[model samples]
Target: MMREVLTFRGKATAGTEFALGVAAAVVVLLLWEVVARLEFVAPQFLPPPSKVIAALWTMATTQHLLWHSLISSLRVWVAFLIAAAMAIPIGILMSSYRIVGAPLEPMIDFIRYLPVPALVPLSIIWFGVGEETKIFLLWLGTFFQLVLLVADDMRRVPHEYVEIAFTLGARPRQVMTDVALRSMGPNLVDNLRITLGWCWTYLVIAEIVAADSGLGFVIWSARRYVKTPEVMAGVVVIGLIGLITDQLLRALHRRMFRYL
Candidate 1:
């Protein structure tokens, strides 16, 4: 069983996969701890996981960690939902009709390539240092890329499906909504899952400029004070949150697309 698990491209049970993942994480953490204790890296710069965990506890108790986490999570979700809502329809239209896509695609392509951080100043000037600014930055980071992805997913829907729907007397709109969009459902969800991760990656950039009361702000504050443990703890929290959200989305995809 162990040999099979180690073999390239070999199948493994769910439990075996889970155990392997956990074992790998444990090994990495142990090595990190050893490196920290042996002073290979200064403890101030690379605190052991134990100290990081302790710092997490301290922040949770004294620094309104839950509140900050909630704030950050709320910002991410709100921006992501808005991006998804807008991107889906636009993406569908663009892919379903060349007239809609022709002029729009080039502009979207250009805007999406522009760095989000480079636009931070404009975002701050436009929205000010407030919730709107953070949300805008987060939304900006996600929307353009997601729009393209959504369009690509729609494109991947077989033209035969559209032809069959048309043969059945389905209207043009019906062919789009019922055939193309429905066919793209699983892939759309997967695209969203990937985009949500990108949103999280932009969180700190959104909050770092001029903000308060989010996980990013917490990390930035700790850094200014040279509290390495706190900084690491905050990063770990963001990573853990991202991991959990990703797993939830994966489970949802599996359940919803069981046929696939």
Candidate 2:
């Protein structure tokens, strides 16, 4: 039957994808193990994959490194959410109103070019040496980027949609709600994905300043004592968490914008 044939083909495709993923993982691990054992690079600087895994396990079990890393990741995500929430609305408003955007354009441009890490001193002064400062720094780094992206997305929405809405006797508010916002969905999701990656990079910088706990703090502490394994372990944790977050965002985008 055609149904049976289609089911078999679907299973075959899934199996092939799974096999490719497993094979890629195995190849990477094998290469890492060989290079580390052969001392192709200083093991201290480039720890073996096995050593990294062992170090990760030890830290996870004994020192709660995983917990610390999770806390840092949560802080980054929270800051990112706050930034997106504030930026998207302001961006929409600016895009929708030329007068507002024209006046603010130069200031926004200036701030966008300012390196966020350089603002750590001011952040520390404003927020003090607390979690607040770290979160604030992360927010600062992500907010401007998302604002510009969202504003651009709004500007690029098809003019025809707005005209059609207007022709239907829709008010400006209705046009924005039904046409402009709907059109901006895919681009907004794309910007969020890009912003999430930016947030990860900024989180490390944020954690470096005035942080008592976090993966970044762990890495910083390890470097002082020359605990390379611990430092590498922290790096691995950040990468893994970032990858997981990105994949989740991608899945959410697919589900929310299925029509796109």
Candidate 3:
């Protein structure tokens, strides 16, 4: 009887948590609809959810939303891969060797503090307002931070584990790969997922730099014309895409790291 009661309570708690999120979203939307319907705020400034949905439908049907969204997503992935590829090896080296870590740590610390939006002017000057500029901006935003995260993950491996590998006739390289990298695999993946979310946070900054298409461009362009519904629609699309990709990454992380 006690076990049955506990089981029922557990399921009830789970159901309540899920329902809370849905209920909160519905309440917010209802409030928004009420404000817009009653003209509590200017219609041009805060369109109703219905208007945003209509704008989304129009963009999806007439404006090739899929194509631009694909481009933005591709740019994000490319930039994230570039950052991860460069950061992982350098981070591993930093964690493994004091000589490598000491000289570069200060520079990386300083660089990570610089705002990514502040780099747009330099990015434009260097990459000339093209796709490369956008990708580079995203890379710059993620790389330094990700390097620190990777190094931290590497450092979390037990020093005793590496010592055991060394005692068993493992070479330095073997200890790095077999002990350090192996132990850090799940953490490295989790860090990558975290940094990927960071990349999405910079999508608007990346896409607004003289961009002609993509969701960010849509938002920027609509703002100039005072198209509130379209602007909100574009913002919604970016959020949805980010949410979907983030969920996918979470699922992949769970599948890859069952221990987590």
Instruction: Order candidates by lDDT, high to low.
Output: 1, 3, 2
Report the C-alpha lDDT of model 2 over 1-260, residue by residue, as the tens digit: 33543684544456666777898999998998898899989877777888878888898999889779888988888999999999999898888899878887778889989998889999888989888998888898899888988999999999999999999999999999999999999889989898988988988888877787899888898889877888888898998988887899899999999996
The candidate that wins on lDDT is: 1
Number of clashing pairs, model 3?
0
Predicted structure 2: lDDT: 0.87
**Where does candidate 1 clash, by residue pair?**
none
Q: Estimate each model's TM-score.
A: 0.97, 0.90, 0.92
Task: Give residue 36's error in model 3 in angstroms.
Answer: 1.4
- Tens digits of per-residue lDDT, candidate 3, 129-228, equal 8888989889999999999999999999999999999999999999988888888999898889889989987878888777997888988999999999
The 10-residue segment of model 1 with minimum total lDDT is 204-213
- Please give the CA lDDT of all the candidate structures: 0.94, 0.87, 0.89
lDDT-better candidate, 1 vs 3: 1
Total backbone clashes of model 1? Answer: 0
Weakest ten-residue segment in model 3 by summed lDDT: 1-10
Total backbone collisions, model 2: 0
Candidate 2: RMSD to truth = 4.6
lDDT of 1 by residue, 97-143 (tens): 89999999999999999999999999988988999999999999999
